[model samples]
Each structure stands twice: as structure tokens, then as C-alpha cells.
Target chain A: MDTRERLISSTRELLWERGYTGTSPKAIQERADVGQGSMYHHFRGKSDLALAAISRSAREMRDSADAVFTDTGTVVDRITAYLRRDRDALKGCPVGRLTQDPDVMADPELRRPVEETFAWLTDRLAGLLADGRTNGELDPRLDPEATATALVAVLQGGYVLARAAGSADVHARAVHGALGLLTGDARRSPSGQENR
Target chain B: MDTRERLISSTRELLWERGYTGTSPKAIQERADVGQGSMYHHFRGKSDLALAAISRSAREMRDSADAVFTDTGTVVDRITAYLRRDRDALKGCPVGRLTQDPDVMADPELRRPVEETFAWLTDRLAGLLADGRTNGELDPRLDPEATATALVAVLQGGYVLARAAGSADVHARAVHGALGLLTGDARRSPSGQENR
Candidate 1:
């Protein structure tokens, strides 16, 4: 990979693993195996590099969601596929994890991508739910905006539960719980593999 | 407060603000206005003191939930009270936040209280849900444990969204969303003050 690509990927990994405050420029350099001159040549500094990384992470998040969202299926089916997608549950969401970092939150430039990711996610999901309601697939009275927010929260919060317990089972259970509530049909959304 | 009490409280705040890896022994001593001798005399080290603070935080979490969970109301009503309770929404959950701290998650001792807090929370909510089912207050087919897990995740994930956006409104929205779903009544949960 080019030095810029290497630096951005390293920053992304560090941001996910250590957070903004915990991750250092020197660490980024070491991880990317690029010298300080190379890093500076590619970007202004740590914050600049982080922004690039975060924006990339946010784009990736939306892309993955859209992958399931735009697929051929009923709205509920698509939403379920997105929720149950294979993930490193214990490692947590790359974009969602940054919310806990004080440094990232203090800087709006740093926080923008994180905010945009969720905004876009909920907006996209809400649109899908609205389509379902219009087509008489979901309850007419369902509040798509609020329900969409809740669905996104379940995925983010499921990671929190999974990490706290040091087990992915709790995360899976949380997802199924949400699916049960949304679908109003537990039999169809049976709680699958505990550790998957 | 006593020296020991001061140390514990200070550690609790630091853990919440800075996390395990970010908080240092010197920082803790300075925050508590105690010297190294006093700090070491009161506890073994950062880990032991953190355990005490985390356990205290866990107890407080349960106490606050019980305050709502045990209130005289229908199961859904009690759950709603807990979800809608006023909070430092942007600051995130004290116990749940630790789940993101790598140092805390890596150590069994540090992680125990966090795990127990969530386990107790989900278990307690599950019991309340089961009661709702038995008493004909909720759907008989509802899976109490999974539903309980999802409810807790909403709260945890709500903080995530709130922090990311730098607004408590999203957290409140997520709460009402879940409440609406669980109760299947959105009108009763008319979206409240956006800033509240």
C-alpha cells in the first residue's frame, strides 16, 4: 500500500482499538511502518489523519448497511439481515466506539463523521420502514423515525453488552429480542447460535 | 469525606472521564488531594481501587433501576419510568461505559463489576417482564429474557447516539421508540421536548 493508505488504515485500526485519546501519532507511525516525514507528507497531523480515517469508517458503515438495505427482500427481512450480519461483536462498531472518546467528541470536525454515520443510518432505515407502511406491510401507525432510531441503538447497545460480558451470546440475544419486538413474531425469528 | 471515601469518589470520576488506560495513579492521587503514601495505604493500586469504585458504581446502577423497577405500576409503566428517567445522557452510563475500556475489559477483576451490573440489570428486567406475561399484562408469547436484554441495550445504545450527536434528544428519542414498540402505543409516547 502507499504511505497514505498505510497511514489511514493504521489510524483506523488504532482508533478502533485504543480510541482517539489513547492513540498517538508515534503509535500510528510505528503501526503503519511509515516515518514521521512520510505521515506529515500525507497529512497535516494526527487530527487530519484521524478525520480521514473516521470519514472512511463512516462511509464503510453506510455501505455495509446499504448492502443489506437495498437487497431484494421485504423491508423487515432486509432490516433483519443487516442486524444479523457477521460482525466482530466483542470488538464493537468502528464508528460507534468513538462516541466514548472525549477528544473526538470535543472536536466537531472529528465528531462530524460519527454524527453523520448515525444520522444517515437512521434516515435510511426510517425510509425503508416508511416504504413498508405505505405498502401495508407494517402497521399503519408505526413511527418509522423513532423505530429506526431504536433499531440502530439495539446494534450499538448490543455491542456494549457483548463487550461487558466478554461473550457474543448476549449480543446475539439482544438482536433477537429486538427482532421479536419489531416483528411481533418470535417463532419466525428464533434465537440462533448463542456464540455466533 | 474520609480519606478513603475521597480516593474512591475521585477514582470513580476519573474512570468515567478518562477510562482505565487513560487514568493514572498520579492523576487519581492529585484529584483526591492525597499523597502516594495515603493512596497505597488505602488500596493495593489502581486496579484494586478501580474495582472498589466500579463495584460502588454497579450498586448505584442497581439501586437506581430498583427505584423504578419496584415502583407500584404495571410492568410496562415501571419499565417506562426507568427508561425515561432523567440522566446525564451525553455523559453515558457509568457502568456501561467501562465496557469500552480495553484495560478494564482485559482484566477479570476490573471487568467483574461491570458484567455483574448488566447481568443483574437484564435479569431484574427479565423478571419484571415475566411477571407482566404471567399477569396477562403483556403478550404471553413474548420472550422475557431477550426482551429485557433489548430494553437494556436501547438505554446503553441511546447514550451512544446522544454522545455522538452531542445532544440528549436522540437518547430520549431512542427511549420513546423502544417504549412505543414494547407497549405498541406511540400516541401515548408523543415525542417530548427535544432538548429534555
Candidate 2:
């Protein structure tokens, strides 16, 4: 990758690990293996670089969600696929993690990507649920928008539980529990059957 | 308050806003309105002060949970009360927020109070759920531990969603949605409930 791409990628990684307040421009340069001049050549400073990185990360997250939302399957199948998709459970959600950073939340420009990503996810999930209800695949009585918000909250909060306990097992259990709540009627066991 | 108490309270307030990485000894002293020598005289440094602050916060959170857990009421009533308790939702949960701080997580001493607080909450909630199940108040097949984790996750994740959206309405809606799911009943509209 070129220096500019390398710099953005490195910044994204650092931001995930150390957050905006903890990450330094020097650390980004070191991680990218680029000189100061090369970094400055591409972006104004840390904030400028972070805005680019966050925007890229947001796009990447949205694209991943879109893949699940548009999959040729039932709503449960698609949502199950999205939840059970390969994830670094211990690392937590990249976009969700930004919500906890005060510096990131303070800047409108820096916060836009994080805000937009979640808003988009909630809307997308709500649409999928609405589609399911329309097809009679889910209970028509279910409120799509509320259920979507609850579904996303479970994943984000599961990370907090896991990280606090220093165990990803808690997160996995929470996911299993939520999936059970969503698909309980189809299964005899408390743990829901794996989605085909 | 004594000097030591003043230092701890100041640290808690600052940690809530700035997090561990962004907080410094000089800033802490300035916020506490205590001299450098006075702070050092009471505690070794920022970390020491933070440890004391975290311990205090954890204790307060646990005590708050204990009140709900020990209340003589139905499990749903108690849980709802805990969920609806007044809070500065925008400020977020101090202990939950610390889980996102890399520096705080890295220090075992700093992380202990946070870990203990969540652990205690999980156990307390699980106990209540178990009681409900045994008394036929909850689903017999429900896993107390898993359900407790999900409840806690919902609350923590609700804060993140609310903060990101810049509205506590989403948080309240998410909480109500989870409660509805737990009860396995649709929420009645105000008029419908009154008529019933």
C-alpha cells in the first residue's frame, strides 16, 4: 500500500486499541513506518487523519452489514448470519467502541462516522425486521424498530460484559441468549438451533 | 469532607468526563482545589487516587444494586424500578465507561473495582432470576446467569446508543423493549391498558 493508505490503516488500528485520546501521531507514524513529512504530506494532523480513518472504518462496517441485510435468506437467517459472523470478540466492535471516547464524541466531524454507522445499522435492521413481519416470518405484533435497537444493544453491551470480566465467554453467552429469545419457538432446546 | 475524601470524589468526577488517559495529576489537583503537596501527602499519585476513586464508585454502585435486590417485591417490579431509576443518562455509567479505557484496563489495580462491581451485579441479578424461576415467576427454562448478563448488557449498551444518538429516548425505548421481551407480552397502549 502507498504511504497515505498505510497511514490511514495504521491510524485505524491504533484508534481501535488506544482510542483517540491515547493514540499519538508519532505512534501512528511508527505503526505505519512512515516519516513525519510523509504523514503530514497526506493529512493535516491527528484529527484530520482520524476523520479519514473513521470514515473509512464506518464505510467498511456498513458494507459488511449490507452484505448480511441483502443476503438471499429469511430475516432470521440473515440476522443470525450477521451475529454469528467471525468476530474478534475480545477486541469489541470498532464503531461501537468509539461511542465511549469523550474526545471522539466531542468533535462533530470525528463523531459523524460513528453516529452515522449506528444509525444506518439500526435503520437497516429495522427494515429487515419489517420485511420479515410483512412476509409473516415474524410476529406481526413485534415492533421492528424497537426490536432492532434491542438486538444491536445486546451485542454492544455483551462486549462491555466480556471486557469487564476479561472473558469472551460472557459475550458469547449473551449472544446465545439473545438468539434464543429471537428464535425460541422453533427449538426444543433452550439454545436455539444453528441457523442454516 | 476530609482531604482524602475530596481527592477521591474529584477523581471520580474527572474520570467520568475525561477517562484515565486524559486525566493527569496536575489536572486532578486543580479540579480538587488541593495543592500538589496535599494530594501527594494523601495519595502517591494519579493512579493511587484513581484506585481509591474506583473503589468508592464500585461500592456505591453495589450498594445501589443491593437496594433493588433486597427489596420485598416481585422480580419484575424490582427490575423495573432499577431500570427506571433516575440517572444522568448523558453522563453515562462511570464504571461501565472505564471498561473502554485502555490505560485503566491495563492496570490490574485500576481494573479490579470495575471487575468486582460487574461481577457482583451479575451474581445479584442471577440470584433474583433464580428465585423468580423457582417461584414460577419466570420461565422455568430460562438460564439465570445468561439472562442476567443480557439485562446488564442491555443497560450498558443502551447508554452507548443513547449517547451516540444524542437522545435518551432511544435508551428508554430499548429498556422498555427488553422488558417486554422478558415478559413475553406486547406492551398495551395507555388507553387499551386502562380499558382492560
Candidate 3:
């Protein structure tokens, strides 16, 4: 690969591992095996490199989701496919992780790619839900946009809970719960029932 | 406060701003206005200081949430109180933010406090949902533990989305959406169904 491409790829990986504030120019240079001068030549600094990396990551995320969002299937089928798609769950979402970085959040240019990626996901999911309603796969009363937002939040938030607990079980359980809600067969324990 | 307390507090603030990987002992010392020898005199090193900070942060977070969770009110009232509780929304959740730190995730010592905090939160929230189910305030079919996990995920994930977008609107909307689902009025949009 070219130097610029290697730099961008390295930045993406580092950003995922360390976030914007945690990642440094020297680390990027070392990871890319590029000299400081070369990195500066390609981009102004860490933020500039991060902007490129974030933009690239966002594009890749959108493209991957687009494949599922545009697939010919029921809305549940599509959403399930998207959710169940193989992922490095423990590593967390690359684009989603950027949101926690103060430096990234502070810079509009750095934050835009992350923002647009989620906006696209929510809008696409909403559109799919709209289709589901029209096809009688979902209750017409379901609000597509709001449900769409909740759907994405469930996945993203699941990761946080799982990571914090150092286990993927909570994340998987939450995903299952959300899917169950969507499918209308939500599970309940007797202990839970007694509260009602 | 004592020097040790000052150091822990300073470490907490720096950790929040720069994360585990980015925060340095020198920075902590500087922030605390303590000399290098003074810091090293009290703690072994950066990791030691970080553990203290994380543990303190965890306790603070639990105390903050406990105030809402333990309130004598209906389930919805408690959840809503926690949800609408005044917050530096853009700054994000202190304990929740650690989930994004690779360094913290890699170290069991650093990760334990984070794990305990979320685990406690889930258990606390699940109990409330259980109460709601028994009181007939929620659908009997809902899984309290699973729903509790989802509820926590919404808040964490909302911070991610909101921070990424540099706008709290999406976060607020997502929270409202989850509440609607929990309350069995999931069909309504943010505009109170007028948009539909």
C-alpha cells in the first residue's frame, strides 16, 4: 500500500484502540512505520490524520450497513442480519468509540464522520421500518424513526455494558431482549411477574 | 482535602479528559499541584494512582445513581428522575466512559470498579422493573433483567451518539424513545404523535 493509505489505516486502528486523545503522532508514525516528516507531509498532525481516518472508517461502516439495509428481506430479517453480522465485539465499534473521545468530540471536522455515520444508520433503519409497516411485518403504530434510534442505541449501549463488566454476555442478552421485543415473544421470569 | 485525596481527584479528572492511555503521572502530579516526589511517595506509579481514581469515581457514580434508584416513587418516576437528572450531557458519563479505554479494558484492576458500577446499576434497575411488572405498570412479558440491561445501554449509547453528533438532541430523543417503549406507548414520535 501507499504511504498515505498505510498512514490512514494505522490511524484508524490506533484511534480504535486508544481514541483521539490517547493516540499520539509518534504512535501513529511508529505503527505506520513512517517517519515523522512523512506523516507531517501527508497530514498536518494527529487531528488531520484522525479526520482522514474517521472519514474512512465512517464510509466503511456506512457501506457495510448499506449492504444489509438494501438487502431484499423483511425488516426483521435485515435488522437481524445487521445485528448478527460477525464483529470483533470485544474490540467495540470503531466509529462508535470515537464518540467517547473528548478531542474528537471537540472538533467538528473530526466529529462529522462519526455523526454522519450514525445519522445514516438511523435514517436507513427508519426507512426499513417504514417498509416493514407497509408490508405488514410491523405494527403500523410503531414509529419508524424512534424505533430505529432505539435499535442502534441498544447495540452501542450493549457494548458499553459488556465491556465494563468484562464479558459479552450482558451485550448478547440485551441484543436478544431487543430482538424478542421486536418479534413479540419477550421472555419473562416469575420473579419479574410478581412485581406486577 | 488531603494531598492523597487531591491526587485521586486530579487523576479522575485527567482520566476523564484523556483516558487511561493518554493520562501520565506527570500530568496527574501537575493537575494535583503535587510534586513528583510527593505523588510517588503516596502511590507506586501511574497505574496505582489510576486505580484509586477509578475506584473513587465508581463510588461517586453509584452514590449519584443511588439517590435516584432508592427514591420512594413508582418505577417510571424513578427511571425518569434518573434520566432527566441534571448532567453535563456533552461531557458524557464518567464511569461509563472507561468502557472505551483500551488500557482500562486490558487491566483487570482498572476495569473492576467500572464493572461493579454497571453491574450494580443493572441489578438496581432490574429490581425496579420487577416492581413495575408486579404493580401492573409494565407488561408482564417484559424481562426485567434484560430490560434493565437495555435501559442502561440506552443511556450509555445515547452519550456516544450525542457526543459523536455534538448535539444532545439525538441522545434526548433516544432516551424518550426507550421510555416510550418501556411504558408501552412505543408508537408515539417525539412530537407526541402529531408527526405521524
Which candidate's lDDT is highest?
1
After TM-score superposition, the amount by which residue B108's alpha carbon in candidate 2 deviates from its true location, in angstroms, is 1.7
Compared with the real two-chain complex, what DockQ does model 3 have? Answer: 0.60
Q: Estimate TM-scores for all models.
A: 0.97, 0.93, 0.89
Listed per model, the TM-scores of chain A against the true chain A are 0.96, 0.92, 0.92
Q: What tens digits encode model 3's per-residue C-alpha lDDT throughout B1-196?
A: 8999999999999888778887888899889999999999999999999999999989998999999888898888999778656666567788888899988889999999999999999899889989988999877888888888888888888778777767667777777667766776776555532211
Model 1, residue B139: C-alpha shift (Å) = 1.3
Model 1 ranges off by over 4 Å: A187-193, B191-193
Model 3 misplacement above 4 A: A188-196, B187-196
Q: For model 2, how does the per-residue alpha-carbon lDDT over B1-196 read when each residue is reduced to its tens digit?
A: 8888888999999999988988989888888899999999999888989999989999999998899878888987788777667666667889998988888888998998888898889888888878887889877767777778778888888788887887776676667666666656534321221111
RMSD, one per candidate, in order: 1.3, 3.5, 4.6
Quick one: best DockQ, which candidate?
Answer: 1
* TM-score, chain A, candidate 1: 0.96
Which candidate model has the greater DockQ, 2 or 3?
3
Reference-based lDDT, each prediction: 0.90, 0.81, 0.82
What range of 10 consecutive residues in model 1 chain A has the weakest lDDT sum? A186-195
Q: Name the lDDT value of residue B133 in candidate 3.
A: 85
TM-score of chain B of each: 0.96, 0.94, 0.93
